[model samples]
Target: MNQYVALDNIRQELTLRTIPAITLWNRLEARPRTDNFDRALKAEVRDALWMLTKQWQMGEFRGDDAGSPVTSKIHMSTTKLSKYVAGNHDVQVFDDTVPLEAKAEQRPIPFTIDTQKVSLDIRLLMGRQWLKMIASTGNFKTAYVTKYAISIPDITDKNDVMVTAHREAWQQVAATAQRCMDGYELYIYLKSDAAHHAYDTIPMTPVQQDAIDILAGKFIIWYEKLYYQPLDPENNAWKPDFLEYQFGCSAPQGSGEKVLTADQYCDGHLDWYSVDIDPLSTTLGDTGVPVAPPKTYTRSFIPVPVTFDGMPDTRWWTFENGRTNFGNINPGTTDLGKLLLMEFGLVFANDWFLLPFTLDAGSIANIKGMSVTNVFGERYWIEAAGKGLDDDWNKWSMFTLNTKGNLGELTDPGLLVLPVTPKILESKPLEEIRFIRDETANMVWAIEHTVPLMTGASKRGSEAADELRKRYQQLLDKDISDGTVVSPVPVYKADIRYQVMNGVPENWIPFIPARMEGSNRSIRLQRAAMPRILNGDAAKPEKIRPRTTLLREGLDIDLCKPYFINEEEVPRAGTNVYQSYQRSRWYNGGVCTWLGIRKQTGRGEGHSGLAFDQTIPVKKAE
Candidate 1:
């Protein structure tokens, strides 16, 4: 009688019947949601539980399948339990065949030990399996795929290149995965072959090693969550199994899908909170509507974006200011403006003016010195010298449109801006001078300029004694010719950039600018514009221009050095100097304003700086 029901048969009965698990569990005084102990433990429990239930439902152990109840030929050869038992009862038939003294002895088959505890354990395993199956069927849309290719040859440091790419992808996955599960550990193995059959033979650099360390930290958290539950030592079941030997319970099997009571549900949640709940919360109360834990835990290790204001991100975006003693300019806050580089040298006396003052009195030929090419490809020359026309530059002809407003124009003030790389000529011979038609004025001008003359030939001052200053300037000039300039013409590479605007499709973000917002700056783009080199005749030494702040705050001119003074009037011990060059409250004081410099002479290094109330030639950031 005790051997009648095998554990398998009892499991089948529990699955086939409609026994509520919670009800059965309550009746047996067992933890119904025990498998829901921790998110880490859920999947394993679910898997084992489901397998047990399915096996029971399929009647895997029935009759002989349950193992032979008795060893007698009558039972072993019989087809049914009733038939086998009936065969043993045939005493008269058996005695006639085996003799009067031979009698059949009967031994009862014990029932299999399948208890309520075992049934509950199976339910927990079922939950774990369900979770795993769901996880394996993860939804991956094309939109979420982060596959990208790198041009290996384009990168110089192979190690750095690979490390950077790996870091980038790791960050993306970590961030996205958090939204789903507490966190998931990913296995990443690098391969040199497409089949991933062979791994890279190259040694990883220190940087790569560091990147791997970072990734490992993030990866471990996920692995621990995936396999944290303690296995059943007695049953050898990875999930849950009630060990009858441990508790010594022997009730009939009973399990079902029943909703847990409020108290039970709360208890389950409490256990989850007790553990580090990877992505889920550890607390519960009426603080507000109970927000369920996030579906997953995202690795909170997103690398900060390359920025100009923050460390590592800030280094490349900012530059040094040219006017304020070469002060550091915070690109994070500086407004868009022109970066000017001036070049200055001497002009021979005869080469000072472009057109001859008295162009052969009545020459029919147009003056060749003042020709400028317009955007329409037509060349315009000024030949009105001494022919009922003013010699002044303002009185000369002016073309207002370079390319209309299309070529980086500003509607606020009509000024043309042209970018040109700087050059330094220390004492060179005559060469062809390259010139470009100014888009704003259509007038040809030199590329750049610098201040002329030595301030103190006798006693060297701190400012003038900067040897590296001159060397750095030389290096800057050398760099221009070495890479910036393309021979046969003056040209330079434009590496200007912009920021991506918000509200725009991510694919097109680089080309668009969103409505003004503090956060979303524009994207960057490259365009060819500035010229890098210049060609011209060798220049001669020239006198320094009078020093004056372009926009004076309140400096007294009378107290300042005169622009033109007789040498005899100067004291023997000293010479007159501009107030701006001196250390005074009024000199280089107050707010700095934008100014404009105009070419006063064609050949001479002459420019008259003028202050403007408004910005001109406001070119959009390229």
Candidate 2:
């Protein structure tokens, strides 16, 4: 039987396995950072990492699927609060696949079939761990304490169930959210120092506080709407209990003025007036009339920025209260300068990385890597040659239509050739070039690491021309037999542009080159390796990951490079990035230990294998 591990269970498992915590603070000390701003910024980065890990473990942070962990909670009128998951009602209490025996004589069953439903008591353990981690980060701690919730449950004058349910749900939500927050805290730590600076916000800024309030409101509302169900209907059952609870309705005093029906009023109190209700009358004595409350509110608060100094020079900053007065000092003195530089650097990198993908015209095939170098010099690897598109016919023209001429007249339809152009410009004349397979004995020419051709034509249009084209079609059909064909490109040292054309070589669609390479083979080698390195897949990964559907079906190499490299087989480290806040190596030390073979090209660039969330079938034992 296949068992799927739950996110919370995964977290607990990770906690048990790793001795030292792999948090942001610890990572900061591990990696070299020179500036004061880097030190302060490390804390925030740690928080982000912590938040990410915790979120992942708690099911609070979703991956590409974009699903929330909390499922829907439905409310119905009953004297007892009964929780029913919206769709989970279809789940069988016991496996129905097991046969109930029809024994003639009363014999003891061979296997135990206990039907007792064991309740899970994971709330306290999960909550305590999460709260402690989040509290380590001052920013997260502030957000949590300020926006914490208290449960409200129903009571039968003397017996309260709603109160208990409310408290339990609140505790559960808080615990899960705290884990997510801790993960985020840790994620920030794993990020580069420069990236941390760019998103740096004023510590505990009111805007941030307001954001926390909004999130708290949203999550709490989700919990109440999805997890909390009302048990009492009549006033005597739990009406008094609901109204008297400390965490009861936050609705205004006249919230139920228009709730004419008893049902509406009863549900309204429990649901905080979210139930249907008409607008109050706005006339002289109506509840909707504007009456100022006893308290007045104002938004005119200006707070100063806080600065912490760890530098030793006079040029450094001296703070009186929250304000800092920077005297003329050198670079190492004031923390402000470093913070400013870090922030600016982060912004620049963000712009560069988030730049939109723009298609370059001219040579689409070249940019997309559909062209390959063969013994015929550099040629666009066309898997199949079909009749060109007749403007009148939106469908593909038949290969036999090559007999048709330019203006509906029959002429020698010269072989409809697929164009392949090199993406380089060299002053030297084209001479002495040999495009052959590397590390193979045969004279077989594989287009961009594709399967070898069965036949190679010595002349362009001899008796072998027909045979070559036939072989090409055979390979084409075989490659594309499964599904859509995507083109492939030859290895290049630098980025070249290409435009795709007719589907060829099984799943491959062809493309025209944008910038043709120069006739220099040496130059091509440099460009080829550069792109491979940039892609986080070094020349040799200990284990080459299986090709994805796109790659397996022959997607254009250039287009697939980014997607493939991103889908590397490198395993993820288990420790939370924000674990440093715990002040224990057990929580943060091994956070990124799984990233053993780091790609040497750039910082923050590394191989990412298939994520844990992807579902792949496991082979069953006989």
Candidate 3:
């Protein structure tokens, strides 16, 4: 009930005063300003000679016939993206410089199915780490250990019986990489180099080919920076939900009958291209207006002066930067963008400008306007400032790219893209997952929140589902202490009282929504599953499924298929996604690596009390 104010300079409680002054105004004394005449803070200007007679009666020192822009040019065009195509494969071509978000969410190596299929314990753990690093460099044995039925044993034996006699050479490189895998799609999809299913077959030698080139170069530094690529399992093509792209530009020399398109691009960069999408420009007819030519360019710069982050200082009695307070801007009489951003920071911060220019990581440009030139050899040809009516949201623009034009057409001009990328590093995630939304259990759970394991390391998804339910309760207590184990019996009939569907933990999984196939109202989400009653074959239960590979996409085409997901990409604030392992170097310094996938937006909706019909009644013993 007693707080006072003003006692700064580190006296902790600096300002509290909610009416606690209590009359303490101390400035008492026998005064001492016996007239020194320098009372400080007044600084001249009391109409300094009527401000120099109104700057010579208003001609304000005359000096404005315009003359600043020295040298500029611009006139761009560019194009390049060459071809890549996703979904139904077959179009590839961008030759080679890598990035389209690391070949579309990474993964050209590291195979362990998230439906990229390879798994048979990743082909016998890459053929038992290529026969334990070429049997610790001694007898590079490859006689298919007595031709296929496999049995080499003595690499000092007991490494799990030389890994169960090379389990038929890792089940023939995971069945020849599930019969030569392939897949492709834009914002997600990748599965191609299953390390050529271990030397395209035939028990190889050269020290099991240089110990699988040092274990496929450490699964190219940790499974492409840690797993992603999973989408096009028949997700069809041509903008399979647009990681966006549209290429094909023309119009120079008799306009090739007008049409030069190219910037319908999507927002996934780090050296752009939408990883693949070009099958003869797949559809959007009238051939999406383009005839092919565009390349021009033309540089020439020099116009500089425009700065940002809290600027305001073109003098008018300057000395005011108490943190950019153009007078605490209280704009609201129908704020016209805060009255044109405070009239361009108090009068067009010196008519702002910059120029910039460069363009070449994967090209796209299209400027078509500049010329400038000033110091009065006089030139003035400017034109590309948010031009107009592409549906004019008061003509605004920033990184450009939207293209297809259409809304009452004719505005067209905006192109940009660059695609540069190259700055890399990443790491931390190794599988996160989130994906909430529950509406009190109406579906969407995902939730693993870091799982990874199979010993490549990672934990806490409730400690890996309580160490997978204590190794399935020590394999149901070593099958009940091995007494001719026969615990499978449930045939009840007396009013059918035996319970069946009710278990959950393998990290919460579920998803649900449904409807999309011929849309009776277009719905999406899908994924679903949550039964895991630890299959002792109670007529095949086991559903839990997800240990993170971004929610195991489609469990290899069939554990009942259905994956889906698009219901406007999970709303009510939730979706996250994680994986990680980037690296980067290129342009000859080499070192690239991959495994990307990011996704964001979550911190909302959750409720895994995922239920189902059940019973809890047992009174006989009491």
Candidate 4:
């Protein structure tokens, strides 16, 4: 709507005396601050009347009924989580030496399973040490020690005596220490009966026990280090995973202790919020345990305002370069987290304070009440942020555990849990298995991307599956070529007219939806396998089992049983579970080592293209 009174307006405006022409444009300027403090555009009076006026308009001058809290008498109670039980094991002490995360997730090194020696690592490492020990003790003849000797390549230019010893010998004395080893002890560990798990020579002698201890005990101790270790074991310290194993730390002290045995720990990571008190009740899916007793203590401390890296500063006459800019926040209605955080920083940041208090890692802590002494010598008792009827949905607070029980059970108010977990280490996944739901098939597939081999190395699932099938094929070939069979006929020809079922990847172990417990309505993913018909023989069907340990829970038993995963664990989006070697140091500089499982969210559902009752026509030869 441009008004044009052209010629007349120009003549009328020519009579102006003092006023200059006014113009308007979008404001833009080059901002270059070589020196952080630039006073060119800064109004020096910003800290004067302008600040006061702004604060006044925002009601900052409104006097509070009482002065701000200077110190807080925190009456807090804590119970040492004195019990820890791994899986269904007996309850034992919850040692506070190592972080609970390490304890809960640590994998124990089982020496053997009945007749079989379980690990090649145990044999290799322990056998090498045994030969060294023997040589050092002069217990065995030099010839005998040399017979089972193990040698590592000396990485030193020690032309002096087989090059410069084990180089950088000053770093670790053990590295340069001369040992009676020639790598032959690895063979000894494999062949010798003394190294076997069930080597029971009738009338066992002291020498035999000593040999066993050196071979097995030392190997076991290599991974299992005590927090307050004695001189001998500490001296024998070796590299290990982020797992520290102790003898008597498995105990269930109170009601909520059962949560540890549930599926949450199945993946090794412990998320306190998802845990339910009644883990034994399958209906709840995720369970937690309500521990007995509440501890109380009183300590006064000068409260400090809670601060975060990007949080807004209180002063208005300045700009925080990288700090949160509330003005720049373009939050949508669904961005509740961002919106709430921004709102809190802008309006309620001053109301929050932090206190530093230490608690044992496994135990939960609750601040019963707090008496705050203000700057005016006025004391005010403060209640918890969520101090109201426990059943009220509106009452909310952070870090509080949920009260769990059946209906009509009088529930105690949930306590603020401070589980002593730490930011521990996670190595590259040794075994990766993804549990993906196939909605069309009404089944779940445990796709093993990575699998552990017998040689203590990880292999791609596809390659490992191929190797496994090759092994089975070799066995079949050996059987077919046997001379005892008189003109052994192949059960079925490889060039068949029809195929019964479509083949899926051997690594994709199927989990059929089965009735949970006895309820047909409630289904769980029960581990199932496709039958492998070797040499096209339907009668000679074999189980195509999973190679990944996460999917082979109950299959290795004498009587193979179905392993079931909770349906909720594998949701529509799916679940990714991985086992890896973890290594970290605890609070006391004690090395933590373990092989633990970690679970993450999968991308989405997957299609295995698994089909049954298929028909295939014979292909014409070219």
- lDDT (CA) per prediction: 0.22, 0.24, 0.53, 0.56
Error of 2 at 436 (Å): 29
Q: Give per-residue lDDT, candidate 3, residue 528.
A: 75
Q: What TM-score should be assigned to candidate 3? A: 0.31
**lDDT, candidate 2, 1-622, per-residue tens:** 8565445565665667552333324344356456457657544443567666765776644434322122111111111111111111121111111110000001110111111101112222322343564343344544433333222222221122111223343344435442333222322232334233211342565655555444434433432222112211111111111111111101112222111111112111122121221123211122232322221112211222222442222221233332333333335656776656455433332221121122211101111112223333433332323334433454333222222123543221112111111121111110111112222221111112211111110111122223333443444444455434433434444344242221122211111112224643321111011011111222331211211111222222335432111111111221001000010011112111100000111112222121223333433435
List the candidate 3 regions with Cα displacement exceeding 4 Å: 1-96, 111-359, 362-380, 385-392, 396-441, 445-493, 498-508, 511-531, 534-543, 552-568, 571-611, 614-622
Clashes of 4: 35
Per residue, candidate 4 scores C-alpha lDDT tens digits across 1-622 of 7564445465446565223352335897877757566676564674578778998897767766537778888777665554554443444445567666655655544323322222334434554554565454335434433444323333321212111121222223234234433232333343466445412332345776566456545544553462222222222111111112222221232343323223243444455654445423322122244435546678889988898766666665566657556778899989888888888877776678888897655655656677888789998888777665445677676655444543533223344343444566677777898878898778988889987543344667776666556555544555556642233444444455555577777888998878767686987667788876566342557677666656666555678666777677777898887778777677687777666667778889889887677655555556
Model 2 stretches astray by more than 4 angstroms:
1-139, 142-179, 182-190, 195-199, 202-558, 562-622
Candidate 3 lDDT (Cα, whole model)? 0.53
Clash-forming residue pairs, model 3: 84-276, 84-277, 85-276, 85-277, 87-184, 224-595, 225-581
Q: Give per-model CA RMSD.
A: 49.5, 39.8, 27.1, 11.7
TM-score-wise, the better of 1 and 2 is 2
Q: Estimate each model's TM-score.
A: 0.11, 0.12, 0.31, 0.66
Worst 10 residues of 2 by lDDT: 575-584
The RMSD (Cα, Å) of candidate 3 is: 27.1
Task: Arrange candidates, best TM-score first.
Answer: 4, 3, 2, 1
Across 1-622, the per-residue lDDT of candidate 1 in tens digits comes to: 4344335565666777644441335355555765666775444444667776766776643433222111111000001000001111211111111111001111111011111011112222332332343332233212112221111221223222211223332343334332322111022232122333101232455554455445444444443233222111112111101100010000011121101111111011111111111112111212222222211111212112221221221122235333332124333334433111101111121111221122111011111234433334454443433332222234323312111113332211111111111221112111111112232322222221121111101112222223313433344445556765333432334444232221211011011112232546532211111211123212331222111221111122335322211222122222211111101111223211111111111232222121224323334546
